[model samples]
Target: MIKVLIVDDDFPVRMFLNKIIDWNKHGYELVGEAIDGREALEKIEKFKPHIVITDISMPSMNGIELIKNIREKKYGCKTIVLSCYDDFAYVKEALKHGANEYCLKNQLNDKILLKTLKETKNLIEKERVENGQYESMKDLANKCLKTLRQQFFREIINGSWKEKKDIREKIKELKLGDDLKNKIIMILEIDGFHKLKFGPHMRNRQILYNSIMNISKEILNDFNDGYVYRVTDKQFLILYSVHGEKSQLNMYKGMKEFAVRVQKNIQIYLNINMSIGISEPIYSLDRIDEYFNQCKMSLKSKFYMGDHKIILYKDIVKEISTDPIKISNREEKELIFYLRNCQYEKINYYIDLYVTGFKERNVKIEYVHNFFRRIILIINKVADEYDINPKDIYGEDTNPFRVIENMETIFDLIIWIKRNIEIVTGKLRPNDQNKFEHEVICEVIRYINCNYMKDITLVKVAEHVHMNMSYLSHLFKQQTKNNFVDYLKDVRIEKAKELMETHNKKISEIAELVGIRDRRYFSKLFKEKVGKSPAQYKKTIG
Candidate 1:
């Protein structure tokens, strides 16, 4: 409808104009009234009325001034001047300033008013067409239509539209077909799209988005009945028509097949994989929001199922385990113990267990946010114990929680947490400790050399240097390019070879002398290190 705003200083005149005509019946809407030219400009900007009616002489800016101001601002609305019999000069001035026509207040009637409005409307449309703005106006109308459709879709998905009458009216007004009543809602997410946003393709993000959106549209067009809405940068919501299908089984199968084509085409054409989550077909439009949630929840299965697969809502529902997922106090304590002790292997193992438990239990992505907080809290506790500030590991500019929030999968979350834990725990010792890294490794080596004849373990050597067993183990490997245990074995094997050359002792005696009580185990180690069993080497030496 063409919006109309009336501007007049007279209150009764404004009221009469509002009450005189059935605006909607005449394809016009009297949106608002303004006291003078100043107020009219504000209303024009706010309502964007297509036609503005104003009286000639008024305070705080006259109709002639208003017309000139409207022309100066380039407001596209047509203006009509209202004047008294004696105000022809003012009306002429108004016309000179861009007023399209004038009506005498004394001669004003519904017929004349309607006639003037119609002529003004025709003139405006004709001018727009002549200036090549007709198509632009149509585009604007279409844009508005699209916005309404998107809003309605959001309302249905959010379950906010309650009145069936309103829903039907919107459905008719928006021209969304009756087929939408029985539809499947599918949410498509570009796999690892979030990572790409700040990665190598960050500059061409719009191109990537346009490519994905275009591919989705082309593939859906092939299916003959679906609409796609970009819900976010990395996610699109699709409404597919399942209007004629009789069998629920067939409907889902068709939806799945369509989903597969979309997934495959996007991957093939764009070299980008996307995961689709298809909602169960719903017969009622109002139930759309519920199924839309199902689609989103289904997509979370990617944490376990990985990307590029079509996840059906039905499959997820059937497999939904009511068993709650959380790290038990005992499990949390165990993880903390491993972290505090700088047990890198144990820390890595427990992180995997926690993350894997999430996948195994089919935990919702929401729960994982809390799980991230829990793990970070546990790590921070160890950081506190060591007086190591978390910022030292996480960095002042980075938010660890935000990083976890952006993670695409639980596995990614675990990898991130494990890395941060390693950094934090590796810093548990004083700053000066790093200065003595070589000394620490040499001391460890000297201890092993002196004690090669006795039983030696990583724990025993860690006690000798009063360093963390895990850190010392890591340092030993970093310094000597071999692990402590392997180094100890090498030391013992070398001493045993010396004994073999200097003495005529049996293999078992030599093994016992080097702290390898298991003679067979010694022989295995000796053969591995020396490329021969002890007796074979002894005979060769002889």
Candidate 2:
């Protein structure tokens, strides 16, 4: 219900106005009445009415003065001015002071007053909707501006923003001036960003972006003037003005330490590898763009130097004189040859050589992934030519071609690739010598199903098959198209799911029956495979 207040110096007028209108029927309630505008203000504060119907000629404060005060106080109430005369001047003044309705005292009636009140309420609601829309638009504009700033920073640091006039215009737009003389740029990239799966349900992009922005904000809070922007989807640009005491290098080092601390403290935290680019101190605003490019070059150095803690513009320039050699096709083939042989030590040696070579030549991480992808394609082609199943070679849980951790040695990668290839291709040929391999696989599967409640391992399965553990794993995948561990887990999960659906078994009992002693691990595995917990699955069946 809408609350209303009536203010008129004449007691008879207030009483008549109150009685003439059926306020309750019209979805309104008369909360209070005051003889003067000053008294009306007091009642307004107490009642917090939605509508105020007041006389224009009141002592202490009139309708126009009261409306002015309400507007100043930002009260979202509708005001209707009551006047003895239909004077154009009084109506205009009341309207200008945020009054929503104007009524002449002589012409006052229930119909006129009701119609005026209804119209005022409609107008009030409309304004509220429009105000909400304005706020939404304002928020969107701020987000767009932030994105634009990040883009500008990226372009400037990369030396793409070369035009003086363009730089000036951007500076004017961002309102950054000579005051930001001690500006420092920090380029932060999420480690294993490409490995992260982004799908309809997985909002990885937004999560990473928000995390980086939040961290940047925390780091720059102590600095008086600083701004953080998403330079790219993967990288963030933090622009901060260091106080006179701290050098650019010192500030960059501090930010690196802060980033490390944050990563350690936050669970599921991004292993953020940052490349800080420190520009020379600029006294003039015109050189801001130039320094930005310098910082970008510094960041680019990370591609060659690997995950760098800090890179300065001066260091990039110093190393610019010599160009490093690119990895040759012959070298790549040689590395693959070593990998195919399972020469783990040799593979490490070559990988180290390749990484060192790339560092000397300044190859970026993006290029490295591309190069590795090409190598994986080649390995796949080789496997196909040899009639080898690629999945059998790589196993189920691990990617043979993936570069794990900071293994910069090409030799180590080569050995990993070879071992995976051998695993897949070793079983491509028929078991001419071992005629009992298929029977062994069948018996193993039967044993796992029957004794799933007991602790089982590859060794037990191998012993039951009267073969070595490694050979049994190879034969299992070759025959069943899955790894031993994965197949075992799947069998256990399926049995648990069946019990949950057909039998009235508790979750703990089901987990124990599946050889899963840890209830939490059982639940996690159940949810991952079945898309719900054991209890949830039972509820659905019921």
Candidate 3:
């Protein structure tokens, strides 16, 4: 219920007004009352009422003075003035002081008072509804802009915006002007986006999206009449009108400086590399799709030119070379040889060369996936020849298989494979004939180490290892002579003990670095595993 504060110099006037009006029926309640304007001010502070009904003539302060003070303080309260005289001067003073209505003492009755109260409530409710609608519209606009940005980014990354009608509709919805006179499309792509991997539960995707959106908003705030939208997961489209027929080179210089500011302010590890596609301002939105394609092609130029830079499509026209980098029979043999011999570094080196070559030659990453699948088939045949378990060699549990699904870059896949291969081979003692079992243990250990921040269960470990959940549970116990969950806790405790030896870092930082995201969970695990909380352990060490 809306709260009302009744104030008047006369006690009888206050009591009679209170009894005459049905405050509840009028959607209000007399939460407090005062004899004079000064007492009313005190009660206003105490009750924080939404409406104030007061007499204009009072001691120490008048109704007009009280309303003036409230307005000066920016208090959101409605006021109605009461006076014995129906004088125009009193009404004028009250209105000037932000009183919503004026009333004469002799004219006051339940009918007039209730009508005024209901009217005030309706006005307040109307303003609230209008504000809420504005908020909803703003939210919807933001969401639509985000979706368009994602679609645009995907097209740029995928090398073409095939959906022309959809692009045109988005541009129209954003109210982006068709007087593309001096308009340019710049694609700001974050370098090494594929290298930054977050586990599924980390919600890293949303974090990255929010970061890009916030950074884009900050950068675009300088443009008086331009829209900046995320064109993709890692790219943003900046649509701005170039002021006063600036030279293309001058515009490029300005864009580069803006990108540098974004990098400095955002603090993301990757530098912003932009590919600018300048369109001869066309009068039609249909032409935007063509320019969008050109902007996308500019991003592909980064594959030919190395990192930490910008590429302009106009500048690279003559040098735009496209030569297909076919996976020759000999190259395939060499790649397999590196994988089989466990030369992981060489594997990654070749993968980078392969991906770069493909980008330069206009070969899509999906096509490269097909090539890799074919190579994997050949590798399986070789595994069969050597009588090695194909499942263990190219196992679904292995990082190579998982990386193929998650990682966009060949380098990422090679790195995962290399690390797993090292764990399989380097950590095994001589005469350990059960190499596959040893590899599974190493994978489990790696999972435990990587996920110490989460509640690591045996089922989760087994799922990662791609074994029957229960069968792996029994196998893990037999192999380690301890339950899988216990082993994981022991591993976390051991890491925590090492962290306690360091005097500088906080216990929380150590907990996070060791894979425990929650400080409380880390402390609990520390207590469970080491018979003491993390703080206690630190104190004991100190």
Per-candidate TM-scores read: 0.52, 0.56, 0.48
- Candidate 1 segments whose C-alpha is farther than 4 A from its true place: 1-136, 158-169, 179-182, 198-204, 243-254, 268-271, 318-333, 352-357, 387-389, 428-542
Better-scoring candidate (lDDT), 2 or 3: 2
Span of ten consecutive residues with least summed lDDT in model 2: 424-433
Clashing pairs in 1: none
Candidate 3, lDDT over the whole model: 0.66
Per-candidate Cα RMSD to the true structure, in Å, reads 20.1, 12.5, 12.3
- Candidate ranking (TM-score, best to worst): 2, 1, 3
lDDT of 2: 0.69
User: What is the Cα root-mean-square deviation between model 3 and the actual structure?
Assistant: 12.3
Evaluate residue 465 in candidate 2 and report its C-alpha lDDT on the 0 to 100 scale: 78
- Candidate whose lDDT is highest: 1
| Candidate 2: Cα lDDT at 529 | 92
| Rank by lDDT (best first) | 1, 2, 3
Q: Please tell me which model should have the higher TM-score, number 1 or number 2.
A: 2
Error of 2 at 81 (Å): 2.1
